[model samples]
Target: MCNEVWLTSPNSNTYAQENDDHDAKSRVFCTKEDCEETFGMFLVKETMYLPERSYSELIRSSDTIRNARFKSVNWLITAHKRMNLWAATVFLAVNYLDRFISIARCRDWKSWMFDLLSVACLSIASKFNETNGHSLHDFQVDFVDTCFAPTLIQSMELTVLKTLAWRINSITPFSYIHILAQSVDDLTKRATELLLCVVLDHEFLEFKQCVVAMSAVRCALDQCVIKTSTKNVTFGHLETFIPQDQKDGMIECRRIMAKVIARDREILIRGKKSPATALKVDLYDFRNFSADDDSFLRTPEINVGSGKKRKREEE
Candidate 1:
């Protein structure tokens, strides 16, 4: 029964060919004024199609490309502070929550609602964390102002808290290790520090670049130690640190770091990756005390108007 229906369906080649021919003739007839006027009177139908130009052309244009580069540089210099930080925080929190809910459970109306609720909670938490004076009620008011109902806002806040906790738990181990290595006096620590200092000074702003430098360093150290007969178990006595192999991994790491830093700095200075921008308004309130300025004194003022005037004009 299904086979028979499939064979005689409108999707059949004969029916499709006839429909295509009819569509072509109608399109051709519509292009003519008399036929369009006659067709328009008979059929009061709306056209569904709209014309579109390719975005690739705009992206490829020199001015557009230059502007995009400038925008990227501006973002790096300002650390994306010109845009609403709250909006960005909310978006990031919501997106992460949505991903977590989608991955842990099936996508449905219930899941979507749960994700939204989670995002709101996390946003509130972040606001509270960032601004010590802000209360939960303040967050609630802000949420409502954004057009969310009280019930939805409350639910979202709960979900966001849970989602954030889960994400933190997953990355806690790696985060701890990364933090620990920074404070340690080991060779790995030194290598990592050099890598970080180089990369952080540049506009790349990615941990993966640091990882690549670390990997290259490790590989070079391993190759250098392979030639030596004595097995130095302690990191301090490693051959890479003492004699230093010309083809050592640490050398390669330093080279890579230098190259990345040099390239990124050039890009940044050229306004291709780090454009000049104003400091964040929120950061303006922060004050720094200088010990050197403690002994500085204000000189006594001599008022010109209060001084005795010469009697030359009267004479």
Candidate 2:
């Protein structure tokens, strides 16, 4: 008779012990579990990670709040590219920003405050997701004339952590992309990029993270130049994630994503520059923060990635 045994590390008090035990128990160690029950489990588990406010609710806020969010997100993207941080870092940062704002309800926030909050969010996310240490100086990139003190940034970060109740293990769309895409490397890769772009668009908040992820996978499936094997996973297999009653919502989500992608592609085709690349000629005013203090005025010392610098020199 053969016996099945679960193996655990001798140092079970380590951080990975719980994950190892959970994986052993759930039998979800593989990233590409296509079982219907596994999908159902994921769907249920993802609900807890959703933001308090939906996209519709967020958009219903005053113009000041909406514009602040949009600008802060753009700055985060710029900072992400400038610092060469991980995609997961920026995704988690945005998740924190959304959840914090929904709960904090800071409608009277100024532009510079939003900028500070954005920096704080990215800093918190980088610490959580990256092995490399990032200082507040690294986050000060892309600012025109305003620089936040480390203390201020740290304070805002603490506020976010408290508001989120220290729930830093964010389950973003990236979490489900591989499993829902059936673990195909090509499809997973493309879907991941699409989801990254989708997260930038606030419209995606209308749908659940699972739905957005599934939609990105479908979009990637359509864009696949090579036909993937469907013996194990097919379109019908993905459809099972969405019930007939909820199919319309999925379709709408996909539609929003298509428009988002189309606009993204057009921007690339037109060679439009992102905010980070645009020339900064005008000095940012600090009148909102203080009319007398000049201490906030500091030059931005942004570093260009080696690849980008080399490409630019070649051009």
Candidate 3:
């Protein structure tokens, strides 16, 4: 307990590392009992998570998006890349928006709601996680052709806030991302991209977030090998980081994600869908409101499946 500010305040951020504070240089770690108790509390809290969609419900949509959730994931990933933001913040934003849609059972996946929801959720996510918050102008410019009035954006934010009961800090796959990953490099960035994809897929709902991140890490490292790994990362190098119990799940996720990536790559090679050729979810019975408003930005005819090959923009 030398020159250390003890875990003194109840209002202190539990999320911060004790060692991050210069004052805690010689502070003793809380004993095993404390660690176990904290972990157990986390496990109990995890049980409260709402599993929004089942495998059948996800695949059996009335619309013909053979992979409805998959497309949404792709959309989110592309938007994130175009914005040049942290992958995790984008993940957190999409997590909030997707979970809200699933929980609300808003079958209107094709509605204007989601477009607005995307803007609001990303702004909120940036506020929570980023040092600098995203502005309406930032969203408007980055999402060209999809322009919303500032008032409309604010209203939608309030609606999403209420719908989610203002729980913006809900647990996400990214929380455990650091545990499975060693370093943030090209391989890890690709892994995060894969992680974002799987998290949005209802097909992978059975697996936990940790399993998804671990699988992504495995898949990304494998891609690096094929693509000429700049970091020389290998699956075996990170194997010890994964828990023994999760190895099986990680393998299954790796297989599934690889297949997904392969399919996306095929699409990219063929060129992305033109705005006129965009596909909708199977259940596109009647649009309460067109999500395809002139205000909404449709997927551009760029290389959609470009994957990690798309060079990161200089920050």
The candidate that achieves the highest TM-score relative to the unseen native structure: 2
Task: Give the per-residue Cα lDDT of candidate 1 at 205.
Answer: 19
Candidate 1 per-residue lDDT over residues 177-249, each given as its tens digit: 1222222234333333333234223222112222333442443344333422223312222222222332254
* TM-scores of the candidates in the order shown: 0.25, 0.73, 0.60
Candidate 2 backbone overlaps, count: 0
- Global Cα lDDT for candidate 3: 0.51
What is the per-residue lDDT of model 2 for residues 1-315, given as tens digits with 9 covering 90 to 100?
A: 011111111223433543542353235435435356556665654555566644357556577667777777767766776777776687778888887666556655556766777887888788766767777777775666777766666656665665555555566777666566666777777887787666767788877777787898888888877664533546456457665645767899999999988988643221244444221213555546442342332212111111111111110
Off by over 4 Å in 1: 1-99, 104-146, 161-315
lDDT (C-alpha, whole model) for all candidates: 0.30, 0.63, 0.51
Give lDDT tens digits, candidate 3, residues 104-155.
4545345334556677777766665555545666665534335666666665
Q: Would you list the rank order by lDDT, best first?
A: 2, 3, 1
Reference-based TM-score, model 3: 0.60
The deviation in Å at residue 252 for candidate 1 is: 18
Best by lDDT: 2
Kindly give the number of clashing pairs for every candidate.
Answer: 6, 0, 7
lDDT of 2: 0.63
